[model samples]
Target: MFSERFIQYIKYEKRYSAHTVTAYQSDLDQFMLFLNNPGNADPAPEPEITHPSQISYHHIRNWMVELIDQKMLARSVNRKMATLRKYFKFLLQEGVIETNPASRIQSQKIPKSLPVVVEGDRLTEMLDSDEIFSADFEGRRDKLIIEMLFGTGMRLAELLGVKEQDVNLHDGVVKVLGKRNKERIIPVNTELKNLLKEYIDLKKNQNFDNNSFTLIVTNKGAGAYPAMIYLIVQKYLSNISTQSKRSPHVLRHTFATTLLNKGADLNSIKELLGHANLSATQIYTHNSVERLKSIYKLAHPKA
Candidate 1:
């Protein structure tokens, strides 16, 4: 009952994305299960914790220890801890608990790693090569998917949420529903605008029962899902780049890095990528710095 209310609060009041709400609910459920069965590792029999008030710092610590024992990454464990901290903070605010048990717990320090980005030259080669993409509907859709992600720097979820009406061909702009359901307009190039018009015309000719009004759809005319989008990107990226990480997010990182390398300001990139804060966009600067260092090493005779 308490969990349900908490879910509702985060969904409606906090306006969290469905994906985020589902993750929070999963974390809470796992914690509850842990409380009920502290596990067979303890030799001494202990009472099962039946209520949130009964939870203590020791219980939370033991859970973290178990997570570590399972070889889960520190970043993932910290996310779970964050979920607990938020839940307990909510409980304390509602007067259900006198204090937050997760208050004293500290998150694990995570090492910063630069995101992988596809080179601009390679992307240009693949997109421009007629042999890479077929003339069929599937080919057109796949090409558009790559162009959209690299061109707009939109998240996979945002791309999936795009609708036919969200695209303005004449204005050469596409409306993207970003994180927290915030909408942003991204300009499309002439080539992409023409592609969009062609794709829409082809889609209309097929006339499948696509009542959802989603812009991207499967061969069956159903809305595209995350896994489907991932596979589509992975298959095409494998043909050109040898990056270990070839997901849609890599394309987003590629978009930001390309812009930064070409002299686009961080603030402008942040707004284009729909980042709520500049910090999230600053990661791309590291890639830009690395590229500059490479160029300097190759060109400067003094070095």
Candidate 2:
């Protein structure tokens, strides 16, 4: 149906990250489920909405309330709402619907939350400790995972998409396909560059066929998956950080926060992180400010 067409539109034409596309599709499915009656219908006599024309602002608002009532976080609710927004827009353009009913709906208000960052020194110590990572391929590979995420502000998807051909060790830059399939060149620091070289040599010597396409791989010489990378990052981060969140995203936050704290401009960090706009990168500024506030509160003398 049109749902398949809508999904393919986002996946190919929009070039959204696979994970994001999956989430959007799932959200759309949930919305359709909400439309279906009797089996899993709403308390009201909501008809099985088979067409985009049947969806109205009232349905979307009710769905939002239902999601909130189900204890879905505001951010999650907002994202689902975003799915409706995009879906309706596409339907309007495709002539499946005349008006975008999902338009003009305000998003749920969310509290401002700063990105979580680990201290630079703590990360340095963790990466340097011989006790932390082993000398073997998996160990080094895992370590490089942490290093690359923290050293560069790349998202997990971007890191997983790196290919051997994309690396230019001599030039000290690596190409990454960022959100929406946008290509951007990120500079590799000397430390990360050296680590990359070592990792590549190890992979080649080990003769892993997976290294033919992707840079990071599983122990069985296959391309890595999201859960694997998440587990690897979570496993190593647990050693150094006690934060509730220790996923690859935390390291990305650390990377951006580190750059902002180090006086790097927002535009530079935006370029490095492959953000489409500066506002996304500007959150690091808030992170930096909050960090400074914490320091002042800890270090200030008698008031």
Candidate 3:
């Protein structure tokens, strides 16, 4: 019964990131697949059969070791561990289980890595790259999508989740579902608001039953999926980004970095990013400090 609904509860109720929910789904899928494996046991069961929830710590440790042998990165392993922990925690809270075996399972320590953000001119170029933004409906939609992500520092899911009613065009604000299903209204600058209005006008001429729900949609009028969002971000920015990962999250990072460099308070940035804690927002401060250190080194006339 653990379907996308449970995932949504984690997203809305627990305030987990879209990325976190996807990872949890993947890890739980893998664990379920492992449990359903009958080759290692007596009298193989049919495919898609459910298994009991009596997993041992040794089994989890073995799974971690297997992931290591498969050359999964430490960050990935740690994420899987976190997923298991969350799943068990949910099970316990729901009274589905008396104890969470994953409670003692320690996540692999991952080194803190600063998020990569596209630099000034590159960011401008990425935003201005109109080769993909033709004088067509789809092109205009893509451009608006990119602008919203880079402008708002919003997660792609939040952008895709935007409803027509949620936007206050008069006030130049857009309300987005932030982490834990919390609502945060972000101010849309004049330029961004103008572009969004244009996109909405174009969308008005399209056929869509769900237009009442989602602000953005595919050419087929379906709400944008997370993968589609990633592809759109990658299709536009990979050419301009110096870093290897040029997904929507990079645009989010760029948004945070730009704000911090311009003197936005950490708490404000946290609210904008919908982060549950200031610690999550502190990463961008590190990026700003590193850039400041570089600028100081380059400008100081120390002998």
Candidate 4:
């Protein structure tokens, strides 16, 4: 039977991201609802067929074709295919199925799109430190958030997962819970340390008593949600350039690109970003190279 138990399995047992779990649920729920065949345990009208697990590769292919015919974007179609593939893989792993039908299904060929990142000067302009810190609590929190993002280049999820005790005020370091629940410690600079202290002082006056260990809190004193973080980043960075998509990820990309532009090694950047592999972090190098080509086009001679 379709249940929340599967979602709990993915979240607690497999340590999947909330976003990932939501997508998996959507994919599986879609299939389960459509599975009105006789053998299915779901209490739905029969589909005039038996053995729902007998859903074949053709079924998945048809689903893809249907979405495409419905005018879905290529990227959306690809993501849906990926979700179905993951669901089938999960079923295979759990011994509920003999083979993964979705595995044979090919994802649509999406063009190689470059990452949208803030330029180095704009990044510097935003994190100028003096301009960030103000007498207000919101100002202080904003300053700390920007500094942590630009400094460590941590993912938005990792940043939001930061705990109060994880930060070593004296040492000026933060312990981040990265992808796959991997823990990494990144040092914060003096400016960030001071700003964080001020923010904490402001937070204490609010008398928050939530059990969540998150560092950033909402105006209502609850821990920050993923969407709230994205909105905050978008509110600040929307004016810079419409060409560059603004999100917490852009701040992360800006962090890595700045480091690469300043000659930081790729491997080190990978470690800092908590990427599973160097290849994941290598996109920043492409951004850096593009920047170099732009400058060279304008500044170089003998053309």
Best by lDDT: 1
Predicted candidate 1 versus true structure: per-residue lDDT over 238-302, tens digit per residue: 98888789999999999999888888999999999999999999998898788889999999998
Candidate 2 per-residue C-alpha lDDT over 1-303 given as tens digits, one digit per residue, 9 for 90 to 100: 388999999988888889889999899989887766474455666656767798888888877888988999999999999999999999899999999988978998999898887777799899989999998999889989998899888999999999989989999889999888889998888988999999998888887654466899899889889999999988888877888898899999898888888899999999999888998888889888877888988899841
User: What residue runs in model 4 are displaced by over 4 Å at the alpha carbon?
Assistant: 1-8, 33-52, 70-75, 129-134, 209-213
Clashing pairs in 1: none
**Against the hidden true structure, what lDDT does model 3 obtain?**
0.80
Q: Each candidate's root-mean-square deviation in Å? A: 1.4, 1.8, 4.1, 4.0
Model 3 stretches astray by more than 4 angstroms = 1-23, 36-53, 90-98, 125-132, 207-213
Computed on alpha carbons, the lDDT of every model, listed in order, comes to 0.89, 0.87, 0.80, 0.76
C-alpha lDDT (0 to 100) for residue 217 of candidate 2: 88
Candidate 1 backbone clash number: 0
Residues 157-252 of candidate 3: C-alpha lDDT, one tens digit per residue: 789889888888999999998765779989988878988888888888875776655888888788888888889888888677656788888889
Model 4: per-residue lDDT, tens digit, 1-303?
423656777789989877678887887676665444344333544344344367778777867787788798899888888877766676677777789889899888877767778766876676674654476767777767777887778888888888889989998889998876789988877878887888888888767676445789887778888888877777667655565478888888888888888888999888888889888887777777787888998998942
TM-score of each: 0.96, 0.94, 0.83, 0.86
**Reference-based lDDT, residue 123, model 1:** 92
Worst 10 residues of 4 by lDDT: 37-46
Whose TM-score is higher: candidate 1's or candidate 3's? 1
CA shift of 166, model 1, Å: 0.9
User: Each candidate: how many clashes?
Assistant: 0, 0, 1, 0
